[model samples]
Target: MHQGDPRDGAVTGLQAGDAVDLGRGTALLGCGGGGQVDHMVHALRVALGADTVPVVPLDGPAHSVIAVGLVGSTTVLEEKTPSGRELPDALAAVERWTGRRADAVVAAQIGGVTGPAAALTAHAAGLPLVDADLVGRATPRIDQLSLFVDPLPTVTAAAVTSSGLRIVVDAPDPRDLETVWREAVSHSGGWAAFAIGPVDAELLAGRAVDGSVTRAVRTGRAAGRARDVEHLAAVSGGRLVARGRVLDVQRGGDAVSFVHGSMAIRDAGTGAVVRVEAGSEWVHCLVDGEPVASTPSCIVVVDARSLRPVSTDRARVGDELAVVVLPGAPWWWAEPHRTDRVAPRAFGIDADPVPEPGQRPARGGVR
Candidate 1:
């Protein structure tokens, strides 16, 4: 209900049209991962026949918040459509386990589906959705949450397997939260509806990535008018790193990954080889074998002409593509510890955080 502060910005709420734009925006934010979310967009539209899912202030006057997201194989999710009980069931289970009702629904992370899904959960629970997210960009791991990285006190998590199995965990160590929950997901064939929180508003006061909801909407609008990938990059505050033809697509290295691999792009202008790596999300891009752009920056690959973001799975050899690198949320880069959690090193890639997009030459000494 807190709305007056200028820091919260002007985001009022999300409507049906906003969902379409948000889908595109989140897909871009997904950074060559988070599955194509047209299905989730459609679901949000249908769910919001007329009502606007209320967007509460990020640093609003809420007692506590519960964040929500989906985990598992997106492909399986598309095939076995949800029964509409997953979120409600998961929310209920978490509330019961926590022994307190949530005042707001926060997005655990924003991407193609997670953000919209969290909005849907807010609507179903009759609670407002906070204009914020745990992760500024879609990421592969639960541990990437700002809450864990920033390390606020008293975090609780819960999940409901697709089979309706409920599990709750209160870990002293943040990494164990993912370990315990992911182990439960493995039992459900790697899919579940989840909730995390009762995170007090005081913890979120200055730590949560505020205005993320609005940023997604702005990204969606920018993508809609983009005449080309470069146009989208210019308007969206990202740099078009490479305009190229996809030379190769390598399937995920690990079995549990959503869409992970390295795609080799032959820069059309310079002819230098560029390799973009991923493990559920774009990790970093190498320009002529030199790491140029790496997380926690957002790396995007889009169809060159249509300007639509291309997820890692759909990319194929011979596809014309443009790779863009966007500045990471300032919160991640503000400190060494924060960056350590999201940097390529955190994902086991033996690399350091490179200079931001502007500082380094992209491919062939060209940005």
Candidate 2:
């Protein structure tokens, strides 16, 4: 498996316990994308005072296990952060509409700000935070969830805005509900809270990404050693990629897009040049015109100074970033299954996996 962050450096000092505490807080702040560490960190300072935080797993009773996500324009949410109380109200409204008591609250998406947001929502709702999530990485569409895998029946849902506007949509197909809620949220210039998928408690186990809090802690520790503001990424299994400065940005918008853009990377020390294209996730990575990483993998971008992950919605030009590629769960990379599902090619690019001259293909036929 590929290490999560691969940069040139001596490994820094990191402890497992620290990772556990920071990770627990990070998960809660994941707004709608995975928990954004920035928000999680802030929330932690305000909400958590005691030392020695316990990382909570997403495994809990499956009966009435509801999946919740913030749906709306991320841009709007950024300008107007949650009030901390709105999320629980939304959850309660959904419960009232459905008459179902939630056993656990699971994140629907676990990237960007959403990761931490979900965790915070769980904490606020006083529910157990499940380690599992619908999408391990950020996805553009709401219907792209494993909870819909078995063709489940109609579950209840409530889409609430912070401004006290609430809309409840219930149907067999959660996708339809997602579409409706997205449009509503977009129009209102607000975000919606979603709770759906009446999942069987046992199925939620072993399905979500576990140990991410610990992983983040470890990654942060490794990155804390760097003295300058450079590109630093958290690899899945603790590998380093390239560390550099953002020379140019080809795209930027405010529609809550899964990140999509390309940039030129200049090595901080040697001043070497590397051109790379990034999408909703760091789906493809090239060093000096060589492909080193791609999708079905975890690519995290963090502020060189804060050592925290950045959300696609907030990534900006000249933001010094570390591009790290970590191995995703083995299930996604199995055989030829995920070949085009989440890669750059799947999103309509003709470039093949460009391995860094001497490096072999991590999987499949890159040779």
Candidate 3:
């Protein structure tokens, strides 16, 4: 089983179980969508093996922790398996470019593959794993990090692959950083490992959601008893809005890194059928052609009978999944302030959606 002493001075070695534990925390922080948990868990197991990788808590002095991860589409990652040395190479590139070495590394954001990817990189780079993350939940873009939102300079970044492909980017603006990173990822089979510059641990602690990893463990533990769809939702405090097998998937464009698919579910007792629409992170969940919760709300796809998770990329025709709808980040309902930039409108939806009856808006607004 995965076991570690977070109190250990620094991250050092790890095993398959440890990766599983860490990845579980990432799923909880994902807030619904990130990627497939099984794939991430397997990746962690293969990357970690018997080596003990130390994970450092996201606390303590500033500038001590570094953020490192991957950039590009999960679609690409699924189709192209990395050599597992991509992250270590990326870290070396960043170090060479910035003339700085990382003491500890962190997952840029909490997601299925991202967390483990960061951990694996940290292990290979001989750096501790930092506990904190840039966002409390998984985000669609790298610039959405608190460090970026605060207008902090990305300063330097590196993209690497075991295929001997490597690139370095130095930009003062996060937007510019994202543009360059996207280009590099596109050039490198649409996925590349990255190691970004360090940030103030104090500032990160002030904003990051604490004990996110532990939370994932709790959620996973609760899921142990989820024998049916209803039990699974109760374990997550979520509601099962739809269930079905995938029919078709449409990825509109590069900008829309989401999966657009439809599903049909059958009533357990009556054999009645229902359909639902799906996207990258579950933009809109429907029941027989009616929208239950659109974008900004979390839509999770779990095994219809087993309650396990299914990633967007891996979801396919004839696969049974239970669509769970849950509340979104509470900050989304706030005014048009900078912090409220994650509203549904931000995703290109034309209208603001009203909250379901008895359900409070993320930030307390009616819509």
Candidate 4:
């Protein structure tokens, strides 16, 4: 095992305490989408015996890496808990499809419970958890995964629900895989555990978003020293966009996507109107009718007083909130192919992507 820095440097293991910090960081990174971070942390400890889970750096020895996560109603995932075998089964399905065995597991996203949950999947499969992830933040679409960002020779999507329902989709197009898996999830008790890839180290090297796992842990640890939200923002490479009360909440008009809606916040100091447009996750933000932030750039909203991150589905009128903008993974915007797909317009919101403010944290939180 490699040993260098406990938080960053060539780390080799993720202690249970690091998992707790990771949950806290994912809550902040989730931006108002991924929820139940605390719950996943507990589930990880309970199912895996609260022990250290080995961590593998992206540049570590060559191994096949598979990304794992849950999809569908996180609400239902909460009520009827998963049995922890779902993802491992999905992993098996992927292996069957690819005729290859996986040596490690990666989280689909580090934004919510998926980070910890994927870590659990790694433990259950007796594989080291890769220190990388698919999407660097919370995103609703499966097509947006880093693995899907590029064309793979034998990429497959395998899913299994806690109720024993299972599905596997192998297609040339990522959209086809997304649609089929989503349809299966709709009938499989609302949530399904999924595994993507059998990606070899060479291909994974060019595709995966590196260092996201360590970034989440570092961000979470930094939050421990944060005196307030402002201090947290200063350290976490985020900027305050709005500090006010929720004035109104807008719901679906014609497009009934998974929770497509908008929230308006009235700035307490300048009285400027801040509009947050979202579907599945907070995707766009506007101030006085000018686009300030858009999809792929996290729009994190939190309680103005306690600074605890708020969930998008839970936002309502009369809530005092402070909104922050965190830089998303740069991989999405690094190429035309990836940018066009992740842009707001791709999600049906008519707006160009707001130019990224600057450098995003490189898997180490803030700079």
- Which is the leading candidate under TM-score? 4
Query: Using Cα atoms with residue i matched to residue i, what is each candidate's TM-score against the true structure?
Result: 0.91, 0.73, 0.77, 0.91
* Tens digits of per-residue lDDT for model 4, 1-367: 2234656474467766677777888888777776678778887767655567788888887478888988887778778887768888999999998888999888989898898888888888889988888888887778777777777665578889767887888778887877887787787788888888887887787777788878888777777777776887887888888899999998774243367788999999899999998876788999999988886787888888887788877889999988888887888777766776667876678777786676442332211
Lowest lDDT sum, 10 consecutive residues, model 4, at 358-367
Q: Residue-wise lDDT of candidate 3 within 39-110, one digit each (tens)?
A: 666866886677766655666433656677767776667677667778777777777777766677777765
- Measured on C-alpha atoms, candidate 3 has an lDDT of 0.61
Model 3 clashes, total count: 18
Q: Residue 342 in candidate 4 has what lDDT? A: 68
RMSD to the hidden true structure, all candidates:
4.3, 6.9, 4.5, 4.1
lDDT of 1 at 233: 88
Q: What are the per-residue Cα lDDT tens digits for candidate 2 across 64-179?
A: 56677777656666677777766667678778877777766766765555555555666666665555566565655565555554455675677777576777777788568767
Clashing pairs in 4: none
Best by lDDT: 4
